[model samples]
Target: MKSTSRQLALSLAAVTLLSAAPGAQAPASSRTRTHVQTLASDKFEGRLTGSSGEKLAADYLIAELKRMGAKPLPGQADFRMPFAFTAGSKDGGTTLKTMTANGMERTHEPGTAMALSFSDSAEVSGPVVFAGYGLVVPESQNFGYDSYAGLDVKDKVVVVLRYFPEDADQKTRAILARYADLRYKAQAARQRGARGMIVITGPRSPNAGELVPMSFDTAIAGSGVVAVSVKGGAWLIEGNGRSLDEVQKELDSGNPHVAGFAVPGVTATINAKVIRQQQTGHNVVAYLPASGSVSGVSKPWVAVGAHYDHLGRGTTGGSLAGKDEVNQIHHGADDNASGTATVLAIADALARQPRKRHLLIAFWSGEELGLLGSAAFVSTPPVALDQLSAYLNFDMVGRVSDNKLTVQATGTSAMWPKLLEQANVAAGFDLVLQEDPYQPTDVGSFNTASVACLTFFTGAHQEYHKPSDTADKINYEDLDRVGTFAAAIAKRLLDGDQVPQFTKVEQKTETGGRAGLRLFTGTIPDYASDVKGLLLGGVIGGGPAEQAGLAKGDVIVEIAGQSITNIYDYTYALELLKIGQPAKVVYLRGGQKQETTLTPAARK
Candidate 1:
């Protein structure tokens, strides 16, 4: 089963013999180019996930699959698989009110006194305890600090500054960042028996004269305490004749020996509310019945997949271009239209073969949005996951210039490299093999389930994710060769008795596949989110984000004062975050403005 001259000859003979079969119509280079052109053309509108283009493309694939005698999986359905995720936060309204010890009462408007996204929709009122930075760091490196230190905030609303000590040394700032989550801050308050927590940008912070803005992606599912930020809280504190500016200046002097206190004759009340918006998404799958099977043993199905989604007119899908700045149609011809086309070709070719096991050829939607379609399919597989023998994925297979073809997930199975070597003997190409199964493609979804998988790519170029990625740029002959190589491998896996072994990857990777980029924020960015801000699909539990209360769906707009208009900007900003220092991260949680201090760490 390994690479050998005899194996090579046999493999060539088998492919030739298979193609010569009465019903077999080997995938042709002309057909591959036609598929790519048909899928990438403007008539398809770039095949943006959840868009009309995607629907039309799906319809076309379904027709083609039907023509090839494709059927729905074990379960009955058309060629479409569907799933939903947090598209964004709903625009909601909130309110706040205040009553002083002197019987003076004031109620601030919603925009002027913003409600935090994570705040419970409840009310609280009492004497306010001023908590410095509202921070709590464990006994770490002798650098621990607690804003609730020696303070009696129980049953009272606690007023805390938004960040840690202003002038703390780099190490201290970094250490303090671990707990810079707003929800975590509220959690701490609730833990301390406080009814509520209020945040404000003290003189030492980066906010200006405006109400703190809430993010569009809300975080309304944590602790019982309600939280809000008041723009003019200085008047309530100044009632004690202690100027807020003086207190802030003193704290910012690099000596954060700052302390919290009770503001005499000052007390406040809080009220807040929220509304959620919901949306739906879809994925497409088609199945080809087995042609042949082992007589005495159960046979596993082979899954061939590729994402058919792309950034639509620079709207809401992952894009390298600035939001609305580069609004031309992004014709992702090479990104995966190439991969999708190959899947189409393979379906027709596989239909004519003997069914050893089932073949599931899928063209995924919302892949640009974070492999969502693939992830969804994996979550609720049409067939038993254990019955899946192997997954072969093709992405960006259109640009195989110089015969250099990149194959990822070689580590997934010991048989892969040798088999690939054997397959390439007849179709010569420079193969670059990567052992790690982690990649930004649909294959990652199968790999997550411990399924042996492989993803083929030509390589990235300047045109990737750009409007310039048109059908004309695709190297059709190269793409056709890739499809041929992949189809052969798929056929060998399905027809032979040997099953590829699955290897679980254990290499530690930083948040959002940033190990090579070198920085860990513990945030899993939603690659499919087309929002102007960086949308987080997930935050690693117990990581810095969870420690700081950063939750899923939170869209980060700025990091360390740098505007993050896109993922590329976020990447550039990561380089500026000094290790052992806390930097402000401004974000939106369902129309509520919120910020947090995050400490950067070297990627492990």
Candidate 2:
């Protein structure tokens, strides 16, 4: 009887697969080219922030929405919702003065001054106090010994290091990435009654100007901090206050000795100037409403989202294509245009049929700028968040390998596994379900809101974030397949009775997938891990070693007698061996002790 029930379930699922809407009969060539070419077109200007390219992309999305017979969101006549911002250069306005033992003074570039987003040009003068790194990380405990103990930066020029405390490693880099910023530090100092921020370079980097600006893509948006790059030599003034030699000597010796300017006794006369401006950018949004209501359900909304922003012409400098000016467009064909196109395609399909739930389709901006648009949408939703049943996000859905696709969902939602499994079994596609897809993408914001969400991705390729991420590089057939798969899932979500379950264990960070090995694997390795080495950012199940008695911090050092340098080595070595193979694998259990492994087998 049990076997009969299992067979019946399979048969029923198979029959349901046949009921899935067949892809509309459109000209294959036309559909293929239109989706790929339109997005990759140069008119979009690589869809950079506050640029004409992005506006062009917006116009196209609006038109596409209109063509699909989609209506404007409530409370608006048009689909566009405008927002404002300020962007510009700060220069020719700041000056610093140091009192010297003698009566000499030095002047520096006006551009080497900082300005806050909300700040108007102001001049300030104060005694300089050296704050080592100026970081207050509670996690690392690297704060200098009583560095800021009772010290007030209020109305004073606070000099701090560029990166962090004396050491440089992954933890320190991550710390700096999360906390270190001259603008925020200055603001904190200002709030504490400090006048100005003077960031001194460390011995590792004597020149302050050596700190180049990371592209806007890398930083979290809306963190109010103004930073200026200055050179060590430029901070020198023989008689004004301090000498270059004195500052360098103190920096090298790690002593807080330099108090007054060199040749102190002379009051330093300082003049500073700064300039600022506000800039405006726009986000593109489009939605298609569902056709009919469910038999019992009242309000239902299934949203599909994707961000159309790219790294924007590489770092502050131009890319290798001789487009060195930051103004050159960073055509992000695969990064998201692929996802955007898939969303558009899904909109087209749903427009042909109505479901119980209304569909909200959106093409977001500021995703690259830290999921700003999606975050804003969630906070001030066009529709109520509770009404939103599920969000299916398509990001990087255009590429596939060996006909394999990765579908990521925050496992906190119970509906995800069931829906994903049904869709995969129905479609008969080789689908890899990943529980933690919320990583640096728009879907992450929705997941954080406890909204049931799923991200369809083809995994990262070599061209990720590079200029090479052009339209010509997309795999359209695979994209079409992904789009079809997502559409099917969306249809099911609209019909299914399951409400999103907000599980308590929302994975805050990616834990790597289990490779069912005896060795430890801490970080979740990227899909491209094999080619460019594994980035310990993702894992499938608990890493092999962890399930086999390893911990989160353990690093795999050896597998099957082969040295493991990265995730690739571990995976490669795993492939060479077989299931149930008895092997000795070694790894660092934590940072202190090393441990050995035994046999490997299938996980579960």
Candidate 3:
């Protein structure tokens, strides 16, 4: 006996909630709440990416699609798509030892007197070089202080201060704050030919007590140099009979007055290691054929999607719950379990009534980890991107309170607002439409590909990405309404005569979240670009990168003296750059290595 759509709906029905976007009367379903509860249950282990919990979540989605008679997305087998990514770095253990040329040596405990997360597992000893601040702002020649100016640290242990110029003007301080990354400091030292580094808080600097704590090992793989902070490093500088305080005072003045010099008779040994473990995540996909299917059409596909994975135990990526809760289970019921359940319900409704245009339903993983899953799919899509009509996305749709709900991608297509309004007529939701396409979701991946897209969000609450976001916290009735609303919109786009047209909008630069970046390179990194170096897709016109002659298709292999392996390396390298600084950059064009000097400007 074939299961009817009515039977599927009857299998789950028990709740109703208000939409955040105005008034809405939509279908009711107990399964909507049940799904959220089940997904966010403690048994799922928070559905962390690449973990057993994530695998279980993927399997559940696959089984659901199979039950709904949903076919594979074009060339896919079953409903699963897999991908791999580096989930940052982890610390195993570390060691630190110091020695003199005369054979005197002292060894100390690791992670106490000094510690590091992404340091190479190497034992290197070199003469100590007092490279105050260890900064190299070549662009600030007139008023900038370059701790590296006229200082040679090649094959030596260089000591540097934490943070930027302590006495910089408000404007300068704001700009320099973005470059205070510790890894960038290590990269800077290695670029200057230093074999190792020792970090010390300058006496005049605020918070000059102990080094910042490393609660857990970070997961970025690096082999740059052995670096550490020291409890006994003051003796090295004090032995030179010069005041470290005076050195810091002059350096913090934000003007050039002192040059870094060698610390006499002090040799050091550093042993630091960071363990890098690889992990895998998956995406589940299914396709629904058009009623009769239209041929000879430029765009013949419509899609709906949501990320099914959440932080396992709150990884470093999308957790805003603070460092103290790293090991806590992030149920993510509202963060995405609600969205995932909505996708299932919508797919079931679509399966009952097929369309004339192809429908690709995808459930992505790793959205919290920099949109890795969706990025991978869009990069190597089963079908060409141009063939896609429009993508409808549902994320965080489980918590719609009041009568208001936000709908994105309104600016993506001229027909979107009317289409959304028409669909909501039945559901009667007060729809709030946004125009920007640059968002932190799977919708962002499709938007960058010029695909017309719409993303639904119920807004964030205190429970987002936290263990508190359990199924009990989900508003099931609202999720079901959103599902029906989304399904109606998707069906209209599929069967309607007027195809939604794609519009190119200014991709806005995200701000206030990057924490420590003040300058902008204006280089749009191609997340899909698979190259040894960082690839540029579009350079903001008249921005620093464009003004420096950097163009699209240019693969940046080296910046200053630091090698660029990927976006992570490029980000760390960017932190070393200062506003108005001219740094050497090496790129590849059709296999030819070329170089340019980019004078970065203040981030507008």
Candidate 4:
């Protein structure tokens, strides 16, 4: 059944006018209130990725969509889009031991002492071998020997030094693709048949037990090798007189080769016991068909989507400077539930009105885990990609600070600016417009596919990504205005004669930029919140960030040795470090602090 185009257009125009002319505020519909309440309720557990709460939210959305008389996607007969994820352990173990050549056995710290995710217990020890940076790069420096040249690290432990070449800032693509810098070093140590890789931490430092467990980028998360940290100090070997710290001191000062310890009878043991459990989550998609479905006419489709996933229960509280607190629900009311509620209200309005195009209302999962669900949707879309005429996204639209509403990617589509201008004129609401399309939201996925994308957001608040982003903090009246504005935009898109066109930048490399580096990955950055340490909203495919394994929702706490207190700090730090220069990056994931070395690229 198709609706008549002329009638649909007329109806949409009426909605646009009604939404624009506001004499007095109307109370929010029970439907919208209920949705916001339930989705962000404690039962949802912050709508964490790969959790049962997320599934519950999905079920609720599916039920609502079914009630609206919307049909399922081509293949599936339901509204739930399923996906899988693998969340690793927060702490590898409680007990980690390290030894030196002077008969001194020391216990390694948990977060500092990294270990292989999958490794068997072993107790075989051999003489310590020092490999130069544990890196094998013949292209740039032509280091004559391979990483393990003439040196044997089979079954025996490989004592590797930290940090890449102190001068990597002067070259491009100087290291191997997969085996470059510290990641490469760890992988090389594991692949060189070494029982373990002992990484030397920067100088002797006290353990930092106050850090919080936040999400990590994909770069360090996906490395499968196990390793641990070791302090620089002297050690008594089996019948050897030289110390491990003495050997390291000589290497750092000037010596080119290991000039001291080569003992034989020393032995060590490692016992690891880890139990991993599989987790699942679902994406919630609902639709509101055109009001005049019985008539015959062609109408474009508009999708309203937002991810409802948050940091969930982690080792960190809302603030990173506080003590390590666990089992606290990170109620992402503003981070998402706000946007989720807006979608439900729009669905209700569209469901009641005689509209032109079919409206799809979707809530995504795994957004906290690198936009996996949305990426999967774009990869294998339910409807054809071309059929998706426009995408309207709402990430954190509830908090209206200083009455400022930021509409991102207004330039992504030709019709977007005009539509928003009309809305601003009619609604009497001043819309702060920023031309950044690759922002911290799911719209970038649609933008990447060459479809028109627009994101409606209220500027960041203190409660973003924290347990304090509760429903009470939501500005309901402001939300109503935002929702009405979004619906009007959708209506205009459906009724307008001209379709939004993709305005490709001259250089695809500069389209979506992060840290001033040219990155090809299409992921957006969430500048809405600075608490999660400045972070990128998304990672483009095959881009530098992706090449380095940087995933979405991973908080970038530091770049080089600079602390990234906010997005500004992050950008400044990146500016100091030139492109193609490999630098050691320290970030926190799941409460445990880890480091990864990456080479930045020009913005893509």
Candidate 5:
């Protein structure tokens, strides 16, 4: 009776498959579609890191892995691995007060004055100096504009105008705008030995006399100096024998000759406290041991992974949602759910057949927040780093237009070309191979750790990082094909006699994608490091950093005489470096101080 019922069920399944519409997905593709839909649904709340939605996604992935006969990584009790990250920052009771030479004092209201999100949490009181539009263009550009030129602001507070010159020509305005960020201005003040910086929006500019909003800051620490923005501060220059309007008009001429003057007997006291909110995020790690392991044979491990976290509710940054879609769920279907589903499919396929080596499958969180999860994993791994042979990463593989797929980080291993050629015969994909391993994804973490890595991606679209990126837009057939191709690559890595060797590729500097900065230092910062100074993950081969004897695991304490306490300070210091000009660098290696001179290169 049981055999007869099974035969009847098989007949019904065959009938259902035959009655499906033309171009319907097969069983494998159907499973992929199911995974994508389940993960990208509104119930997951976009799978934001450290949120309850992320926990639900983790549970679902854990259950799926268990169903595939995959167990927790070696020496682990469960599949969950947790890491800590600074979720966000907020202001805590910031205040500003001013006193004149005549003993007249005024305390600014909260709405009139506010601290920037990156400002250091401290109290400072000093004499004030009027620095005109604190703009400093890099010397390489030859624009020759410096607001601090010939100004003595040591041990004093600086009052500068916000934004660039309003009356300058388009080309001039463009150059100034590159260095116009408030954090850059604060760094300039700190480099000049100023105790604090106060920014005031000029009356002639747009949004005149409005305090700068406390925007979201992701830095783990402060910007090294007290910085604040005020709606209006005409009284600061009242004792300087000049009205704020006249000074602003003179400085707006773009002549570059206007100089800043000292505001006599005017001292201001500023107290700013920026509190960073921290949270713990988890990465799902599971392993499939070799099919039949020999007791004495040494086996290397290979990894396949993808990031599962995405923007939540179009808030907490990294959201491209439209104004109408504000506060809506940013369904990261193509952004990551497709990649996660593809990894799951690969895990299922490889679990059925494996011969030589173990497989580590990981689902990373906090990827949108600077690859935090992967960075944490590499810093502290369950197995020895040298035992990891290769890593395959899938980022966005759901939208395969015209059968085209981009495979990045191919240069990380010399064996990739032949291996990829062999794997593509059955899948027949038009592969675009990129040599650079300095990608903006989790692959970068593994690459910096000297692991051979490859990242698979389909072309980006208008729906990326936005609320419109829904599961219904995914192409399941091509996604399944991608999974099959990746599984074939994983099989070679797992069953082959020889593993791929790691290769260090020299990264090329492009003119775009550096936030309009012109100088290139070829330094890669480890954003997950908790040290007081900026930590170097790895430097580009044959670049300025490598030539200067800087290597991985070095902490940069100062660059070109500017103190570097965090990534923000390091970025601001880049604005002061000139192409082909040598600058002093101080760093800590193995807890020992070292110094070198590095020449800056111009980005192509």
Candidate 6:
């Protein structure tokens, strides 16, 4: 009797599988594992955007969508949508030469003296001046430390120490550390009319005498001033009868009285060359039409997307790899390949179901480079932005520990909670629903466009953004379950009689790891823009930017009397602003300069 009961259960399961839709009948785990393994394989080269590896991944995704009978979006010739971006930056060639008053001369090569990634490509010859740990603390802090006090650096090369004072007290160190960034120091030198700047790691600081590494920089333009870091520059200051060690010790005391001096008879010439590589990345977009269409009434669309790009060889930055794993391929299995696989699975399942709304499926690239692909899609969308009912994104959904799944951007629509609850009745997931839509993913792109959005994510893990995040570590069973759960949600969106309404949720301002930024302007920068000044993607509702009459497509040129050339400059200028204090903001809109007063609010 027991054997008969087991056989009966098995037969019922087989019948249930056979009765389901053709796409849904396939083994979910097998399909998900195959997709992840192939996409994260060694030959894919970690799918770095604009690289050969990314092209290969695109081809694979296109072929998979074709196999599922998905068609290109309306008005598109093919599934490939290309967008240009700065892939990375590198030193083309750098040369440094110095001549002393004693008729001694020396020339340094690129490796011995490295140009910073943000350095401008220029050749300048100027007399050298030593500026002690070049830092300009904001006046609001009242720390009263200025490295350029009473020093004239116009048309001269300013030599400054890297990092802040090593021996300062904890409170003082914290305050100084906020303004000690190398870019801020270079900005100070440029503001003082310095032609060039040289940096040296002081003897008291860690990694003394080591040249700064040329990390990857995404900015197409330079930092407006030529800058380089040297392994040693003791000879520049030795003419004053003081060794570099003695000067460093004095500066390490963090006293306010230490003054810098000119290096007598030392003239240096610097030539810096930084090459910003621009490449075109492809976003795979396909459409699954509704089962039936009514004449003269276009059906609203719903989108499901996931980014297919990741760090390559851990070289283009965003690598959390340790010393041992340096330069290794960041497989990015759980980081985003898992999300890509889930999207594919969801697409496959939805293709066979009858739908009232058109399903737009996309595989985005350049997400690791600040959601470039998704932003481009929204900026120049193939369809009307107002026609999009909702967007669902999947990222880092491979590892579902303790059956917990986090669904974010629930506040974007009032209907999300009920829809998600209905979908999870079968999934039985321990759901963690968050209301904020300002996430650091593709969902934010949709949110800014006034589209209702949802993103599914598993909790973060130790292997995130590292080479150790390989395909073998993925929880394939849970990944398949996530796909099923998301497919259910998408099904409801596609066939429901009413669409979800967009809701704007006011989020409390927080300094998202930006050092020393205490006030919130609620301005979202368009990172992909190569404009001379910071471009506004969109202003947060009810925030300072909106209240000041700033809107999307505005280019901020100056803030609080400081010039804003790029995002970095904007960040430095933002540090100078005080809470509840209104500052003059100069911006350009429609080729005309405009002025406004923005009163910054304290971060909560």
Overall lDDT per candidate, in order of appearance = 0.73, 0.58, 0.75, 0.59, 0.86, 0.86
Off by over 4 Å in 4: 1-30, 89-114, 118-157, 161-239, 243-278, 290-299, 314-327, 505-604
lDDT per residue, candidate 5, 290-364, as tens digits? 877635444479999999999889688889888999998888999899999999999988877856788999999
Better candidate number, 2 or 5, judged by lDDT: 5
Whole-model lDDT, model 4: 0.59
Better of 1 and 5 by TM-score: 5
Name the runs in model 5 displaced over 4 angstroms: 1-26, 109-112, 240-242, 291-299, 322-324, 510-513, 528-530
- Judge candidate 2 at residue 443 and give its lDDT: 79
Give the per-residue lDDT digits (tens) of candidate 3, residues 29-106: 766765677677676788888888898788777766776678887666667788887665544556667665566777
* All candidates: TM-score: 0.73, 0.65, 0.77, 0.64, 0.89, 0.86
The model with the greatest lDDT is 6
* lDDT string, candidate 1, 1-604, tens digits: 1233354345446545654576665447756665666667676677776678888778867766776788877675667777765554432556666677768888777777777754666778888888767776544235546677788888888887776667778877776765676755775676677888888887657773345565534122323557888786776566667887777666654354567788876777887664434445567787887754545545468889888878777566466765554877787889878998899877777777786888888888877867888877876788888888899998899998889999998888888999999998987889999987768888877876778999998898988888778888899887888888888888888877888888765434643654455567777676645466687766654556666678777888888876664564566467557666788999999979898988866667
**How many collisions per candidate?**
23, 50, 23, 34, 0, 0
Candidates ranked by lDDT: 6, 5, 3, 1, 4, 2
Encode model 4's per-residue lDDT on 1-604: one tens digit a residue.
Answer: 0233344345435444544665422245444555666667777777778777777777767666665566666467677787655454443452356455456676655553444433223333545655645655433334432547667777766655554333333332243322343545655565567766555533321231222222332322323344444334223232355554444444443222433233454434343323233455678776766555524433357788888776676432233222443466777778788888788777766666677767777788877666666766776688777766788998888887676888987767667777788877766677788666766468766776667888888887676666667777788878888888888887876666666776632224434244325323333455333244655554555655666666655677777776654543444355456567887776665656767777766553
**In candidate 5, where is summed lDDT lowest over 10 consecutive residues?**
1-10
**Which candidate number has the best TM-score?**
5
